[model samples]
Target: MTRIASCQCGQLSLTVEGEPALVSACNCTRCQKRSGSAFALSSRWNSNQVRDRSGKGLTYSRKGASGGNVLFEFCPVCGSTVSTSLELLPDVIGIPVGCFADPAFPAPKVAAWCESKLEWVRFPDGLLLLRDQTQPMDTR
Candidate 1:
């Protein structure tokens, strides 16, 4: 299946083909701050899987919990984070689940950085919770 995800202002767009390798919700402080929510939900895809992308979004890089840089791409007009790429996970692009605005989109299977997860936050049953991301994105 093909899916299209875009920023709030429709300036940035990502066209993803086929299914994602993994979907996750991260509760790291950076994720919370960037998403302005309890967590950030992302769907990972191989770089090649994303095609027909359009936009001139700005990128911001920050040191991640794994000590590697995570680059976030946001729409300059709306300041909405549309996608991310991690130095630790080369050739993989992570798309913000919310950008799709599809209620039927695949749900997150894992929750990472649970140590920083809000006390009031609750995860769905069968969701794997990790105190921190210990494995590579492809492994999970």
Candidate 2:
């Protein structure tokens, strides 16, 4: 079955045949603005499986720390941030988990770039945390 979602105003929607490969909370300043929160809840989806149902999305992009461009996609009508894609990884897409109809998706398994985290933002309890993407996860 395909997993489907839409922006708050329904201006943009998506459909995917499977769950995300990963999920996380992004605390960077840009993510804060995109999410309108201390952090952005996001999940990973393969580029090929995600279909734009309500038409193409609007985007704002900039150079990232990787010296690559990071594109932020959103609802043009409602201005709701939806997903992001790195310049080098066009085959992978990161979606804001909040768009899901299910309000109870599992908590993020790990966090990225947490050094920029706000003081009041609480991460998932006892979850594997990261100050940066380098943080090791699990027993591997």
> In TM-score terms, which candidate is top?
1
Q: Which 10 successive residues of model 2 have the least lDDT summed? A: 131-140
- Give the per-residue lDDT of model 1 (tens digit) for 37-118: 9999999999999988898899999999899999999999999999999999899999999999999999989999888889
List residue ranges in candidate 1 displaced over 4 A.
Answer: 135-140
* Regions more than 4 Å wrong, model 2: 136-140
TM-score of decoy 1: 0.94
Residues 1-140, model 2: lDDT tens digits: 57777788887888877778888887777778767788888888889878656656889999876578999888888887777898988899887888886776767888777778897766656667676665643422
Against the true structure, what is each candidate's TM-score?
0.94, 0.85
Give the Cα error of residue 18 in candidate 2, in Å.
1.2
**Clash counts for all predictions:** 0, 0
User: Which has the greatest lDDT?
Assistant: 1
